[model samples]
Target: MIDVEVAVAAHATIGESPTWSASERALYWIDIKKPALHQYIPESEALRTWPLTSDVGAFAFCEDDSAIVALRHGIYHLDLSSGELDLLAPPPFDPRLFRFNEGICDRTGRFWVGVMFDPVAPAPAHQKGHLHSFTFQGGLRCEDDIAELHNGMAISEDGKQFFLSHSREGIIYRFDFDSALGGLGGRKDFAQIPTGIGLPDGAAIDREGCYWCALHGAGRLRRYTPDGNVDREIKLPVSKPTMCAFGGEDLDEMYVTSAAEGIDIAEEPLAGALLRFRPGVKGIARSCNTGAVAKMARVAKRRID
Candidate 1:
């Protein structure tokens, strides 16, 4: 398998999300603190960036030539070509109290996103956040009361398990999932970030059923087997790797994102750069949980009323 950690761009202030667009043959990522979006084309070594007006937590691809972006203030449809944002859903929660965090599109074309207590408020440890599932057809469904900070979300290959991370707690949990209805069940511990090392940031799994988690502040990624044992560790140059996604022509590469928000760039030069390396096993590509879509004719607004 091809393997190497290559610094792909100037460090983003807070690089949090890395997504591969199979259609564009490129990678799309975000700089949370900078509040920007980026597209990196490997073919021509081209990079394009668009600045956003809000602190975008996460986004996922859509068939409508746009991305469903969960912004600081609301959910919007971001025009891929023009970078214009049209409101899809207004602030479902109080913007002053919360903002979007890590989220993705599930195999059924339904979107799962979570929120975190406003970072500037009192310690997030005791604060309550939430994870929500949204469908163009069903509108939006709140899955559960997540922790103060949420990250690391992905579904298992069989569509029966849901993986989520409570970063503040350094714990990644696996839950029973109802793929047909997009419901979450009881959660069990999948892994925990070792003390004094790093917090679990974002995570992904490979064809081998191994879980790959970005351990923020540790400068490394950890691969956990199905049994929740550490199988491998991929180290990096910087100390704050935030997220990782599988992309590339064969989907064999793992692209990682990092944060430079609280670091001294001079001491850690590659802190905010996008990095990629190939893992032997291919990754499970994300899907748009369209099963929920086919059930509804039009997106009738509900909740958030």
Candidate 2:
């Protein structure tokens, strides 16, 4: 068994979206229930948190040192230094019913984000969720297929394939992607996890093209090959490992985030802590948003000026 250690002994409610900024040499993640963005600097063992007014699901770093954030009401451009938010796109569905969930930026600078039924809202007989993409040239494009909860979102290294997970169904779906036109086709089942194991959550792709995913309820992380075969798995100290990301000066360290919101801390000591381990594999640098949303923010600022 690979040894894992606790990096941050945080009591985050719903820790998710572990992203590494190579330029900054820091790891940034979100606490969904707490509605905050956290930055951890490994070299200095320093941590900084920026409080947010709305619930945030996921975010991607931008080339301008800012970030694009998916919040409860809509997507926004976040000023990391000031903690200010500028509206990029308003939520298509009613905010009371649906909210943005998982998201990532592709090599072509298109930000793909997912929507899911809001748990705080009254339960409906049917759930509503969809996959959407945002770009500078095109505002927002929504996919037709729907699901209850959209979790794990990752893209292949060549940018020819997209992977997404429906947590309620415990299935991961793959789509043939058109990078030039931002299109998704050839949708099919990539993999499935038995309910007994755990529902798939956030995911990241490694240099070897293997998908690393956190098993939400099972206290584990798994590596799935390009062909969707499980090649290895690691047991986590926490039961609700929500997401994993590869980061380090060398990009060989795997950092995981967990949830402690509704968990019994007495039973699960590291339930909300950030955990890390060396997975013996280096990860490719993640693509950054090419200042598209930041451009929008600048436009808005100019108009106001």
Candidate 3:
């Protein structure tokens, strides 16, 4: 495998989500602790940041050039130009105890976001986080409450499966999903990282149905085939790669985000830097969440009870 190298000069405190925009040929990601949204242009070598007051968990582009972002207290449309946020839906969690963590949109354009209990340490005996699906028809409702440290959340290219990873539990579960019928079927094991490799953080799916996950403390990216076999693994210079996205003109390159929240400065000098490498596989483009697309997707959205 080709060696991965630094993609940007940034050193985010806790870089999390990485979203690709083929139209703009730019990658959008966020830093949780810094509470900022980033727009990175590869061609011009420009990395612009939009400082946010609250920790924005995740976001997707809108038809009107704004962004649907999941903030600490609620979901809102972020005006990219003015950085103003319009409230859409309030969060289901107690704003004082929990916050949104990771999220992804389905093929039908419905956004699925997961929350986590703040200060994972001293966690309670019961799970407090939930996975929520936001759609034009269903609005925002809890889909699953089994997650604690909700991390990786990805929808399959076929739109037939929903994958969610619980970092604290060290398990990734696959759920049968059918938006047309408002379906969310039983979940089964997708993959489990070994106890020592570090917990799974964020993930992406390739065109071939392989799941690629970032191991936070293991310093590696792992690829699992549809059958749950380890198909590929690549080591990285940083120990806490938060998430990754496939981008570029051909979508052949993989861009990864890392964290510098807590680490030995000397040992992990490049801990929070953005890294990229050729993964030799293409990824399905993310679905747009706006206007006609969002309206059409309502037909496929499954309403939660």
Q: Please give each candidate's TM-score.
A: 0.91, 0.94, 0.91
Give per-residue lDDT, candidate 1, residue 265.
87
lDDT tens digits by residue: candidate 2, 1-305:
69999999987899998988887799999998799899999999899998877888888877675787888877777888787887767777777877788888888888888877876767667677777887655656797657778888888888888888998899999989877877787999999999799899999899999999899999999999999999999998899999999899999999999999789999888899999999999987777764464676667545434
- Minimal lDDT window, size 10, model 3: 296-305
Report each candidate's C-alpha RMSD, comma-separated, in the order given: 3.0, 1.9, 4.1
Displacement of the residue 188 alpha carbon in candidate 2, Å: 1.7
Candidate 1 residue 24 C-alpha distance from true site, Å: 1.6
The Cα local distance difference test for each model comes to 0.80, 0.85, 0.81
Top candidate by TM-score: 2
Q: What is the C-alpha local distance difference test score of candidate 3?
A: 0.81
Estimate, for each residue in 1-305, the C-alpha lDDT of model 3 and write its tens digit: 67798988577888888888888889889988888889988999887888887878888777666777788878766778787766667778777678898988766667878888785345555556778878655578787555768888877887898888889889988888885554568889899988988999998889999999999999999999998899989899999999988888888889999998888767888889888999999987767564324333323322321
Q: Which stretches of candidate 1 lie over 4 Å from their true place?
A: 1-3, 120-126, 288-305
Alpha carbon deviation, residue 23, candidate 2 (Å): 0.6
Clashing pairs in 1: 11-272, 12-272, 107-289, 108-288, 108-289, 108-290, 109-288, 109-289, 109-290, 110-289
Predict model 1's lDDT versus the native: 0.80
User: Alpha-carbon error at 39 in model 3, in Å?
Assistant: 0.5
Model 2 has an lDDT value of: 0.85
